[model samples]
Target: MEAPSFLDFIIHVTGLPGYLVFSWFMILVIISLALIVRSSLKLMPEGIQNVAESVVYGIYSFVEDILGKEETPKHFPLLATLAIVIFFYNIVELIPGFIPPTSNLNTTLSMALIVFLYYQFLGFKRHGIKYIKHFMGPVWWLVPLILPIEIIGHFARIVSLSVRLFGNIFGDDLLLAVVFFLAPWLVPLPVMALVLLAASIQAFIFFLLSTLYIADAINEAH
Candidate 1:
């Protein structure tokens, strides 16, 4: 057999969009969550039940710290779901041969758009007609100037969140691929450790930003 050219190798490796695995992973997460919920309903809390409760409590506390007691219960479910889903999506990249769903721009952008729409919906729901005032600045005179800036800033968050997440995961994925290809044995372990740390930090950052956005929508002045 003839040796493959460098261009051919690059084309072969980079041709696919690489999203089927993400879809499968998402299905797995949903089923796992369902099973976990079912298991947690036992008379006495044990194993998965205990773990689920602990995780729930921690998420609730985190939400309470940001949104206060009144809103914690209301927002906990969405926040917890986002935190867990994103965390899992990110950490999946650490497993050999598994690409994190979040490494894809489409996946990250969809998540970002979801958060964007959610906060906007919450703001309008909480503030009603008054939510429009949020873009109007402190005084009426600055409405023209402030409105555009505020609108841009809000949309910018979607791009920021999506791009930030996708860029980090994609870069990490590429770096790991290169390192593993080069060493394939010893050095990849330490690099894998770094990937794990980066994955965790990215997940936490996403969750934290999400919490802050929700809190802002619910509590900030119009």
Candidate 2:
């Protein structure tokens, strides 16, 4: 097991779960960062504003490529928010005396469930009752067989999204703990760097999969 975070003291005092407390901390951190960035924004985009704009524009371009210009505006907020929040949650493990909330299954599963339900809602909104045709397969005769399979597959996305993120982050934290135990000094530096890269990749992957799910939901081709 990993060493207790500084938040553990607060957790004990408040009788709150560590993940719950840290998750709220993470949200506060993100909100504070957003406020700071907003206050620093300039018309010409210099300093922190430039970096923030670059990050937002890069994310917007990515969404545009996947979702097209028209749909990108509608979906970019959720995609960008997910990517940024998940990235922060993943990378927080690098901070001393902090535990990443993403390392917990509950946090990951909750986010996955939100994505799953949101896309389903979008599908129903876009196509109404006709959205049921998505489960009926390409042929009308396959409804009975395909419906259950399709339902299972759709539900499986929640498991896939949640488990994949939770497993990776939890494994990363475990590895870090073991490494720190074995070598508490310079040896962990390289590992920390790799963890940072992995965190970024995982965040992007979640974003990409979410975009694809939303695209599938809104596409009339379904």
Candidate 3:
């Protein structure tokens, strides 16, 4: 018996060998980042400290843009946690002989499911049973048509979130595979750089879209 693997970067779907190596890579990367950030905490700003501070401030500004001031801090922890975890999972793909945890549908779908549960939960908290009214749309008569659309739309979010991440990372791994197959050394160097860029951007997109979905589920709709 073996662990499952989808989107084999090597052969067709038929091949997906030992993935525990990739899993361990993901864990180690996360622990190392945690340790580094933990030890680097400083009261006074230094050179790279200013850079880090600026990045954190920038993330806050971005969150405030999507969530507004009153509620921005409410979701900050969730947002930050998702961003950190996804980014770590993605960056781990860079290590030799490793696959990104996020590159798997199960892993990515789990994260998307988490987002789905959270928004639905919050909607219930905010609107109670009235949240169901959201699906009926503003016009009562339209509920018949709109209900299915809304339901499908919600499910689509989960699919989109998971697939988008899995597709990008898996494609990244595939592209690298090609590069390695062709030249195996310095040729894939450029691909590795592109992977880094794509990984970060994908993580950012995941965070931004998650914020939008949560906000939409509860917003007043001005």
Candidate 2 has a TM-score of: 0.94
lDDT of 1 by residue, 1-222 (tens): 111254234436767445544545566876788687885698777877777888878888988988899988887887788777877787776666666788989988988998999999999999998888888899999999999999999999999999998899899888877877787786456888888888888877888898899888877684
Give all candidates' CA lDDT scores. 0.80, 0.89, 0.79
**Candidate 1, residue 110: CA error in Å?**
0.4
Cα miss at 38, model 1 (Å)? 3.9
What C-alpha lDDT, on a 0 to 100 scale, does residue 203 get in candidate 2? 91
lDDT at position 31, candidate 3: 72
Candidate 3 wrong stretches, greater than 4 Å? 1-28, 47-51
Best by TM-score: 2
What lDDT would candidate 1 get against the real structure? 0.80
Please give, for residues 6-85, the per-residue lDDT of candidate 3 as tens digits: 32333344344434345555567667865676678788876656665686688788889988998889888788778877
What's model 3's lDDT at 62? 89
User: In candidate 2, residue 83 scores what lDDT?
Assistant: 92
* Steric overlap count per candidate: 0, 0, 0
Best by lDDT: 2
